[model samples]
Target: MYLEYSSTKKREALKLERGLARVQGPPFHHCYTVSPASQPPMWALRRASVSLTLRSRGFNVGASCVKLAPTCCVEEESGINESREITYGGFLLPKTCFHSGYNSSLNFTVGKRALSSSSTKKEDDLEDGFSELETPASDGNESDNLLTSDAELSDDDGKENVAKEKEKTRRGRVESKLFNEIVNGPGNSVHSALEKWLEEGNELTREEVSLAMLSLRKRKMFGRALQLSEWLESKKEFEFIERDYASRLDLIAKARGLHKAEVYIETIPESCSREVMYRTLLANCVSQNNVKKAEEVFSKMKEFDLPVTVYTCNQLLLLYKRNDKKKIADVLLLMENENIKPSSLTYSILIDTKGQSKDIDGMDQIVDRMKAEGIEPDIKTQAVLARHYISAGLQDKAETLLKEMEGENFKQNRWLCRILLPLYANLGKEDEVGRIWKVCETNPRYEECLSAIEAWGKLNKLDEAEEVFEMMIKKWKLSSKTCSVLLKVYANHKMLMKGKDLIKRMGNSGCRIGPLTWDAIVKLYVQAGEVEKADSVLQKAAQQTQLKPIFSTYLTILEQYAKRGDIHNTEKIFYRMKQAEYPSKPKMYQVLMNAYINAKVPAYGIRDRLRADSVFPNRTLANQLVQVDGFRSNPVSDLLD
Candidate 1:
């Protein structure tokens, strides 16, 4: 029993030392030196005999020091002597677990200090700092080899992880052609691919289908995701769980609307109930803002004994906020009655509603309640508070809130973004504008994207403006207003061909060219002194839109041509304006008359037009005519001093 106790204690000590060694890397040493024999000698010993042998070897069993008896045999056969190893012959005081290595000197060192350059060193073993030199060349084609396919974007911190995930998924190619089709091809093609595989006697696991379905949804290819789900439901080989049906219903809600989603709910098997389907249905109601339907669904859920969550209540509250704010109280009361816990989002939205209604005191109380409930204010909440302060003209309060938010390095979400982006832009906060621009680009509304693109132009970030413009065009179809804003960007950058191509694309897509688009083109060309191009855009805009140009647009064209002393084109524009029934502005003809006068041309042409019109341009033209060689009809043109 004594020997067994000692042996157990030794093993425990060895384990503890090894643990310590792992924790204290590099400087520690292992406790025992391994010596290989035909078999492990320690196995043959009696329990007490092993203890006797351990103590007899001068090991001092409990002591930290482990000494080795000499086991070296000196052989004198060759000219050069080599170390011969028989067995263990070294002291070990271990903290680092190391495998055995033969050392003839048997020098044991423990817990050595880490090496640094300040330590004394010999010339033969010299170490020096790196010399000043140019950086090494990089492979230019390396960037070309980077993953360019649009993988589903993750958050900023998860970028590397997502990249590595994509890399691994890309490398772990499955031999199954069906799996390849699902991955390589997007959407509904996955259904066809799976069918092809199954028809050939192939099988699929639940995990594979679930992952593929999830991947499709993540990529926002909902149409294809629904197709796969429908195909699977039709197959006798596979059965979808409750969650699968719920997910399919959600995709329907998104791709279709609440009506179709309701139809989808009817088709669900009796196995699915309010508890399983509530989230997807409530999310649809949230999107559709169908208060009546939402209320109906909530009542049905209560009838079916489904537990209400804060998210469901939040949606009902959102619908409530749209019409009767008093209905918000019912939601809160329902949440309390149901014992549903509110998340930070719940409190934040409540605070925002209170702030917006000008119930500052109520807002503050909710904030206090939030703190009491241990719900911290997030970016959206802070943004709402700051905007309220701004609206109340409390600049200092807004500044304080912004500073606190900045100190936390808080990333803005859709809520804070929509509120604060225009505010930052209007206030000329360029850096904040840029940071907000990145957040806005994730899923920007047309108005916000147009605002961001114009803001980038204001900051002279031409490339960034172009990038945002392209992204907006690719993601959402542009309206006349958006395209006009983009045209102005191209004008500012002097990329005329790009502007021309953009306008052409707008036409090809059956977008009507509004007066604003024409004005934008005319203004761009007029500012650049391209009178001919400006006139071309105006005529096409007038003809294609079948609507008269705004009086201001006509005035701009007249003014630009008059400034160039091109009386002929200016007069032609004045006649077109008259024909278009644009109420006459006297500035139009006076500009042309002055042009004819300064160009040393007779006022004969101007006088003839004035004579034709009695009221319009009569006084304005007469005033300019008195400046040049007194108005005379049928007179030859001549230079005048």
Candidate 2:
């Protein structure tokens, strides 16, 4: 039979159903009655073979019944002549309480009564129910004491969990808000945004600020990173550590120049002036190829009596390796005198220098020395060796080294997978490239995907390259670096239309079009026989970004102009390069001379222009200069006549 419930009593009906379900055994009749003197409200639970009915105040309460074990009942009196017990799910209830308000305190009281009751089995049942609900049960006076302790423990645990959750949420919000503000902030200045964040009462932690700085540096936002560093320093909220000072110095050198960065170093308090700060400056100098400034910084480190670390010496070695190979011997001699053991990087640099000069035997000797010193080569060093081996056409040696790097289990050597892809491709082992790429298929990392695309492109497998590129874009928000890789692949194949489509996709995806993307576009247009369009793209990139296009980018366009004998456009590009403040190299002048030669016109005072730019011509360029000068004395037009 169905029982009707009015809207007002629907909540009570639900409570009745839950209360009945708590009874654990064969159904038994139980009644709750108020004092006769009061407006008595009576409720009863009655069992029939298949149905149990509940009646409250003589009206059938809507509920379902299940058999449940009997539990002790408790009651409280309010100005009544008599009292009755009210039990709810093996717990106590006050006369005014509803079933939904069952509390742990009530369970403790019921447990105490059950413990003292004569029936041992009933007491065990009550204890079992208490254990299920994670409620404390005890005998007599001890129950109250145990209840107090349990409440305190539960409160402490709840507070700890809440605190941890709040901390996690706070850190997440801070990272999200601060990153969004600095990265997507208007214009180049993020200073105002940072200040606004502070004014809004957002706390900035050292870890969060450092992470933001690192991200900015990666994005090549040197100016904005410097601003953030300056703001952090000015706030004086945190004590500046040595690494903090070093990071600021590096940013200064990047955003400003080495000279300005040196000025900043002078302002750093003597207490914070450490070896790392100077090493940072020295490294930046080496990166910029400023040999004179690099040496001066190295001398200053000695003047400060800073321990000459292998890192600093390696920086000098690297600079000398790129600039003057002859000076490398001098640096090696200094390392020997100082008793400074060379690091793996030191040996790698030396090896690469020897490889560049095609000194295979010397490179082998260096490797032997590294092993003799008991310092094993790392993956990077082995990769370097493999690269040189391929360049030297020692394919057998390169293959053996690559096999060692892969080890017995290729799947576990994820770190070596990306490096191996291109090496195998260089070896013309398409099968090995495919094998390495298969290991990355299940969970491809960004670098691995990039390497795979490059490897496929190198092997002239355009379809395979495109497939990897497509898969990478779907899985990741394409960074400009990733897009540039595919663009380069398309550029190499002279697929202008595909490159153009990718550029549109990059724009739609909000990828930052940086120097790398510009380089790829320039190559794409040049390879497709539209040099003018390439030049236009370069110009637009420079204007939009207010940054210099890479030296190779300008050279690419200038070389195209040279090939066409378009001297006017070639001269224009050369002048633009000068405006961009690229160092004058012999190759640029040689390209300029080739333009004149291809035009079959004598460029008068070309040597004077080279001398004015302080660019020294090599022997071959000197001979070209003489040939161009002879043309002026004996005109080509005269010979034709």
Candidate 3:
């Protein structure tokens, strides 16, 4: 509500004017003046004074209050313009509704005294026309006269009309109850009904429907919401509501996530401050993994108002760390300019980002910056820097940092051990690795050290790797993960024989064979041309894994036999392949043909090659024919010709 200035009035006068309006009704209700509940009392009083003057001239003043639902469209005089409405309760006074009601001719043109005089005549005839009326109020009370005259003018079915009004109010309340249950209650059936309502675009208000839609979106029932939105779009009612509805149609864009909903964000009103918009956009961006957009929104947010919350700044810093170091520097500069105090996350982000770039000097600069700002780098920041040093092969620096952390009562975190152990092993710093392990002895980071032990074996530092594994198994009494790690390392380095021996050692130690263990053994046997041994390994692997042999597992043996030109062996493996029912490629038939030809079985070989060419006609197998031990009329050549 807008108010005209009164230079002479004191605060006391304003309070008195408000008191008069509450009892007597607003004077300017006919002119569409409004007094919103949130309006300062002082402003309300001034509006009341103007309103009092209009009412004194016989304008009818009816108090109207609107309680909006969460999502609604603001009413527009012209059908084309639409504004989004936020639902709020308590007091809502709009200027236009007042104008329509108070500016009625009988309200403005006829004086109260004329209406009161006519009410006396109507009361006299009440017995004839309105027998339901018992008695009218005594004549001396002008308030009662006003009430009676108003009732009489509407023709004396006052009791019945009041009852009807009460019924309507009851029905409105009931509808609101049903709507609340469907949208907010725990029942799935109610939720489904609301979804159906949204789909139909029926007589329900947009605010209630949109509220339910957003709730469904939050719950990740996007498919249902999209189906409803699409149905709503086909309706005549929702078509002109807002084109941005399509933008808000992210409910169905399962793959796009929040990235798709972002288009609708800009449609929010310009009247909203940059701070509000940025917060909303930032949240949406981070939720959808759009780190770049999160950065852009954060940058925009700072241009308007530097975020002061620990959460917002931390999130922005995290994004910077994950992406660009330059952005971290930019954020630091912005932080100082905005007079925003840097938190631990700010320092951690700068350090981690710099470390990722391997800019040791940059990381040193961050430390110096933190000291200058009187902010201590926390354990996380130190861990990041320590890890960077280890990656750069600065063992002395990393070790010194870890020792310093210990002296300061900061136990070296498990994550740092995970990183440093592998790094030391790769650099072959066995002594440094042992020292870290001893430090971990008193801590809970022993398992993390296991990963590093495996990394040593992978780098072919087998003696050191075996030493670490023995220590973990004998001293730590840990699980078979240590053995598993060793197994992987051997297999990765193509030391399949070593892996098989390790599997046998594991079995001897009462560690029954894991399938991975058997797979390693089978690979070794097959590579060593021990087909019978490989088949035995496969059987053992199946018994250990409990699950049926995967196709690749059987294919592995068949492929080896076919490649070796061992036709007898390939024929024996074919029984297993048929039982497995694994899909065979043209390559398999070609390999079979090669094996047949190698066995001096040309008839079988040529027949298989022809079948291969028919099924697959490209590359090696797909060629017209192989001119092997030149026969004048090659079967494959004949088929191609």
Question: Which model scores highest in lDDT?
Answer: 2
**What CA root-mean-square deviation does each model show from the true structure?**
34.3, 37.5, 34.0
lDDT by residue for model 2 (151-230), tens: 11110101112222334356342334465567556766678888778888998987778767655553456777888888
Q: Look at candidate 2 and give me any clashing residue pairs.
A: 23-68, 24-68, 24-69, 25-68, 25-69
lDDT of 2: 0.59
Backbone atom clashes (below 3 Å) for every candidate = 2, 5, 4
Indicate whether candidate 2 or candidate 3 has the larger TM-score.
Answer: 2
- Every model's TM-score: 0.43, 0.66, 0.32
Error of 3 at 127 (Å): 95
Overall lDDT per candidate, in order of appearance? 0.50, 0.59, 0.43
> Which parts of model 2 are misplaced by more than 4 Å?
1-181, 184-202, 295-309, 336-339, 600-617, 629-641
Candidate 1 local lDDT, 1-641, one digit each (tens): 00012345445534543443333211011143332121111111111122222232223433243332211100000001101100111101112122222211111112221011111111111111111010111122111111111111111111112333343456453333333456554443656777776777866777677676655554445666777777887774476767777888888876676679888888888975556576567656644445446555655555455555555655555554433333344345334334455555556555555555544544555565556555566544566677666666767777677767556434532434434554565445689888876776666654467668777776777787778777766665445656777788777677788788988887787665666677678877876768788999888768874444655667778877777778788889988988885433334556766677667675655555544442233333445766553544333444441
Ranking 1 against 3 by TM-score, winner: 1
Candidate 1, residue 556: how far the Cα is off, in Å = 27
